[model samples]
Target: MTTTPKHDERIATMTFASVYPHYVTKVEKKGRTKAELHQVIRWLTGFDDVRLQELIIENVTFKTFFEQATINPNAHLIKGVICGYRIEDIETPLTKEVRYLDKLVDELAKGRKMEKILRSTS
Candidate 1:
């Protein structure tokens, strides 16, 4: 999809690797584990630890990183406001996915249960 005149092109260009460290810091400062952060990321993107490290080392753009993902089918269940926008209402697919990741990380930092953050497929 063309992230042209309408969508925020900045997020599209920002490397996932650059944002990754901040995510780690956010969770760690809140007394959460890095492993838990990784788990949430894996749930959203379907990237294992090995593949995730490769993407981080490659410094792939958010667009490229998500393009390569097998996003969870239940990701649609992710709801509520994130960064001022309702997750389910976001029109841009890439932006929505990024927000979903953000919401999940926030949940982890807030001590939300893993089962709840991952959501239910049933």
Candidate 2:
């Protein structure tokens, strides 16, 4: 079996709350609202506002956060490059999911409309 990369391991162990602020900052700098960020996160993770707040307050790791998530079926539709890595080319399941979130946020920051960022429903 292949060992997980050190980068993936480090990211999995990092607190979701720690990374969340960076996500917010990125989008806000590009004129996206916190509500839009929340919506994108909810769409991907299946966590409502209350549950998201609970996770943030608990300081869970990215691994724990995704483990608890009821990820959307539409998540597979998120395909693109983020930070020089292609989201679709990521072989690790957990890492791909994490990058999907990152790609969505990047799209929002780049001013893609909400409907397109969310992907096709049908």
Candidate 3:
């Protein structure tokens, strides 16, 4: 059976290497857990665990925008220190907060590197 993480054991990404093993990238914060890293892996590669293994056999260069965002354990059921990354959860107007996140995801999907994306924000 697929036993889930304990309420306190939600995962997160602390380093880019945890997800992007091939990129030799680094995040300013600490690295995330195996499971936390997996979400980004799946999101970046566009492949589930099963499909990922299959693709690995073909030797492909898959990339994902490795980032760490806070997870609200009580709300989305994904809680962690990473929650600090969500501006909406921390401040007012969650709707606006999500719009920004959506835009970020879109930019990331379009091959925009995280460093470049962050530079624009600052």
Candidate 4:
């Protein structure tokens, strides 16, 4: 497997709350705003600002976080590598979803435009 079972398991159990601060820090350090970060996340997960804050407070694991999400239809448009794994090539569904989120945040931190990152057809 390109990713170890152990590694996958760890990500599944990891709390979305735990990694949220890091995501914020990464984007902020790049001069991006948390609202933009939240926008990216909302585009992917369909969680509005209010629900997202609730999820953070609930400390849900990635598995639960995704289970409750209404993933955007355009999510298939999120294609690229993140953390050394190609998003399109990842076989596991959950892992692919996680990578999709990671890839978006990376794009934001790299200064990709919101429309492009959101896969808008304009």
Could you give candidate 2's per-residue lDDT for residues 22-122 as a string of tens digits? 99999999999999999999999999989999999999999999999989998999987786778778888888888899999999999999999889564
Please list the Cα RMSD from the true structure of every candidate, rounded to 1 decimal place. 2.8, 2.4, 15.1, 1.1
Residue 114 displacement (Å), model 1: 0.5
Local distance difference test values of all predictions, in order:
0.90, 0.90, 0.34, 0.93
Name the TM-score of candidate 3. Answer: 0.27
- Candidate 2: regions farther than 4 A off: 1-4
By the lDDT metric, which is better: model 1 or model 3?
1
Compare candidates 2 and 3 on lDDT and give the better one. 2
lDDT of 1 by residue, 6-73 (tens): 45577788899999999999999999999999999999999999999999999999999999999999
Q: In candidate 4, which residue pairs get closer than 3 Å at backbone N, Cα or C atoms, i.e. clash?
A: none
**lDDT per residue (tens digit) for residues 1-122 in model 4:** 26778878998999999999999999999999999999999999999999999999999999999999988889999987789998888887888899999999999999999999999976
Model 4 misplacement above 4 A: none
Model 2: which residue pairs collide?
A: none
Q: Per model, how many backbone clashes are there? A: 0, 0, 11, 0
| Per-prediction TM-score | 0.92, 0.93, 0.27, 0.95
